[model samples]
Target: MHDRPAPTPTPRSALPVQARLIVAVGIASALHVGKLPPALPLLAQELGLTLVQGGFLLSMIQFAGMTLGALLGQLADRLGPRRVMMVGLVLLAAGSALGAVAPGAAALLGTRGLEGVGFLMTVLPAPALLRRTVTEPGPLNRALGWWGAYMPIGAATGLLVTPLAYATIGWRLTWAVLAVLAALCAAGVRVYVAPDGPRARDAQAWAALRHGLHTTLSAPGPWLVASAFLMYSGQWLAVVGFLPTLYTEAGWSPARVGWASALVAGVNLTGNIAAGRLLARGVAPRSLLWTGYGAMALGAVGTFTAGAGLAYASALVFSAVGGLIPGTLFALAVRLAPGPQTVSTTVGWVQQWSSLGQFVGPPLVAALAARVGGWQWTWTVNVACCAVGALLAAALHARLAQQVRAPRPGQEGA
Candidate 1:
């Protein structure tokens, strides 16, 4: 039987600085995402937010992604990834600066939703930009894996640091500082990354983009991948977003909760980096996906039901292993795309579902918690999501394997 050739290990030095910078910018963009979890408590107290409203604040960033990820992605392809990313950074900075002065929960929610737009614009074009710049398959795969790590790394950084900033300065000032950092990152992107080139002509670009969108939307592969991401993203965000609150309610100190939750989120990098190396070594994406989902299920059960030490440990394992799903899915997004032109569109589709999961997850979980009077029953949601994700992964694996074993055009007889 014919098989796809395994990707060779790419040395770190062989990866381009430009590609690394793009990942850095992604991490920086994610800092905004991570900033909120730690601050949710203070915001709740100062603004008199209910648990449901907190969930709204947690999910507001997904607003743009849920609504217009594909549209903006097509725009990036037509205009330029770098250009869209720059605009996203500006919006993020503006949103943050505005959020600093938001007088009430409603106003803060509005700012957060706007920031979601910026977040969507910043990340949706990343994979395509990386594809354009990092031409080699091995490096590209590894780079995409690191791209998956951007959230956890940035989120963990925010979880760890935001508490200190809030304690010393204040949430508003901390938010303003992050805004400044985002602006600086935008400048860095301009200096470090090359432009995606002259903008496409309106008619021609629109036609191409429309075609790419059609190709992306019509394919079963994109749909399956996006669905699987939806399953994974919702629970992951729900758990991570509420960890500070969970621990706080358990009577842990603010510093302790901040650092501990950061650790859980940070360890996710392990699986993400490993998924890249495993894929390079030719591990089946299906296996990695199932393993990630399985771990998440078991870990969530333990995290909610077990003793404190065990629960914390389980949370760490849940995050670390759960990392495999996003990294593997990202690698699959590249391979499963209908054509080179549709890579961003495919990623945008993936992000759209991912954002939907994020947008819906926290609020749903919060509502559940509100109804049940605690977080203990939240494991049911995680288990359900993981099961759905596993089924999707199985289907995706079979489809990918079939594609690999199918004959090339000139080699039908071989």
Candidate 2:
């Protein structure tokens, strides 16, 4: 009686604040990836970067993800996502700072590889962290939707702001400023997010990590989701990454190109948000994916083959509609994880393929452009990706239906 009941904690009340903070951290991390395109022209001039090298630069930041994503995911599982994420943010700051001082293209390229490692570490664990914090399905879906938008938002901001920053402070200072932003983001995560509890002893922890890796890799759900992401990411990055170049070549002013490219990228957020809301309202994931892919196909054709104004409009449609793929895939990754312990590993696996797509996509498109002497043929790549994605979406639908009909032991008869 004297003790009275301990004050009840309301996680629901705190959910929005925590979720927003987590998303903010993701956005800050994404700024590093987005900062490149706007600065590419300046970097090329200053560092003597060739066209192919520029494409490599665009894709180089994905190197770590392509090679180490799953392993890092396992590390995240062993270390706790919050700890991994904070460490990643610190790494990003360090990398950006170093990159700011690079003397040549080769040096800058090396720093970009370092940034790639940090990028994988920072983003791979985010979906799992969100799942752990937001337990309710509806809110979780919406939160994931926003999580998916972080890249486009950060990228769009970078596109719009970098030219202005370059005019005033130059690219080197801009890099330094981003480095500072990443550090602040890390600090914010430490103060606002709850700490991960104690760890298991070494042997048991290692065994558990091994088990999670095995389970995640062996699961069909992870593989299918990963494949779908591979199909979507390559094409998306290729289109968006080159838009600034495309506009520049068209004789638009730097400011005009920045603003226009930013708007195209920014519109993608709408589709991401819409996907989450639709999922929350009981819409079929397959339907949304199909619609997204179809629109992407149509948009790609229009973007490349049509006149300038129509092409810009088509780019908007391509990005906005294609946004549905990532939103749905994130939600699916959580739901389709073999178990709670495997969520990050599953996400890591998915991210690896996504990075592969990004790593290959830009270079492939660039080569194609060089070969054809224009971007008109770019639609073929996007269309092929869309076709493969549609087939994968169908397979995913079947897999989900099978899962529903044969629920896991704990979920049976519920």
Candidate 3:
């Protein structure tokens, strides 16, 4: 008799359309974050802004995420991710529009701050929403993996398009264009994503808030995940943020610099998507993370030290392979949540650290480069971050292993 064939597992590509829509919302928010980079030179010229002020403008969007990410995450869990996200989109639209008309740096900075808060709200609860949207593990992994790429995807789109937009219509109109895009995204979310209505009262709300915060904050899982993200994010943003300057100094044109930087950011999606597929196929999350961090360490070292030709290639490999970390961490966030109710809170914690890293990383790298009179020593700082991240990944893997082998009492069979 012929041996029977095993049943085929569901394809990762089978993610639901609504889930994809949710991921698009995230991408839209990320576009807003990225739009300002290319516009910085124009802004500095128009506003007569100093270097310090310019740095603030770039990082202002992270203010809310740095200060209130966890709190917003808890809020999203209580009120509803869809509704909060809609509010976030509206804020992004308003901030972009307002910033477009600003008379000076002060006004523009304030608008950017509002955009930051909006961005925080838009992204904090996404993982939980994705978790709820995609119930099955295989498709969910793929979905979450794609979800992780939303940042680089949005950032790359903004980096590549904004400079072109500026050349055609000027910076003010470029800002207005993103405002329109944000508005459209808000409408899409309202129509497509199901809204959860307001829950009872302040009493129940307070209790839920406490529970979510405690659950996320008390767990070692969330801490490890958040810290690992911190280490990876700071270095990633620092390198990508400065690439345009580095290339321009080497005599690349404005257009070439923009496209090259965008491409480096864009290729990160390959690893993000692959991580989901590999996880769905039962690859160990720990292994993927180790590989990512290791690549980042080696890549940064080469990018700073190697000749120009190989440096770019190393950065590309660094970004592509490093994509595995976020994709895996996102999958792990859902699994390692203290319970169903706290998933968003855990993600919020991750976002909080991520914001902190982005806020600090660029400035830290800039300071180091200034001190050394060049970027030659850049790798020394970033490689340290990668090393720490790898260590944290090991700790997280051990924790996950423990949880898997010793399932909770009621969940033993499961």
Question: TM-score for all predictions?
Answer: 0.94, 0.96, 0.94
What's model 1's overall lDDT? 0.88
Prediction 2 TM-score vs. true: 0.96
lDDT, candidate 2, 1-414, per-residue tens? 123222223464344666788888887887887788888888878887777788899999899999988889988888888899999988889889999999999899999998888888989888877877776778889989999998889888888888899889999999999999988988987877777656779998899988989999988999999999999888888888889988898999998998998898888888898999899889999998999999999999999899998988999999999899999999999888888778889999999999999999999999999999998897899999999999999999999999899875554532
Q: What's model 2's overall lDDT? A: 0.87
Task: Note each model's CA RMSD in angstroms.
Answer: 4.8, 3.0, 5.6
Query: What is the Å distance of residue 120 in model 1 from its true position?
Result: 1.0
* Candidate 3 residue-wise lDDT, 1-414, digit = tens: 434222233455676666888898888888886787777777767898754465567778888888888889889889888888889889989999999999999999899999999888888878877876776778888989999999889988888888888899998988898899899998997877666655649999999899889878998999999999998887887787678767867999879988998988888888898999999999998899999999999999999989988999989988899999899998888778787778788888888898888888877887788778888998988789988998998999899889989875444543
Query: How many steric overlaps are in each model, in order?
Result: 1, 0, 0
Highest TM-score, which number? Answer: 2
* Model 1, span 39-122: residue lDDT tens: 888887898888888898898999888989777887887788889999999999999999999999888988998899888888
Which stretches of candidate 2 lie above 4 Å from their native place? 1-15, 409-414
User: Which residue pairs collide, candidate 1?
Assistant: 61-116
User: What lDDT does the true structure give each of the candidates?
Assistant: 0.88, 0.87, 0.84
Candidate order by decreasing lDDT: 1, 2, 3
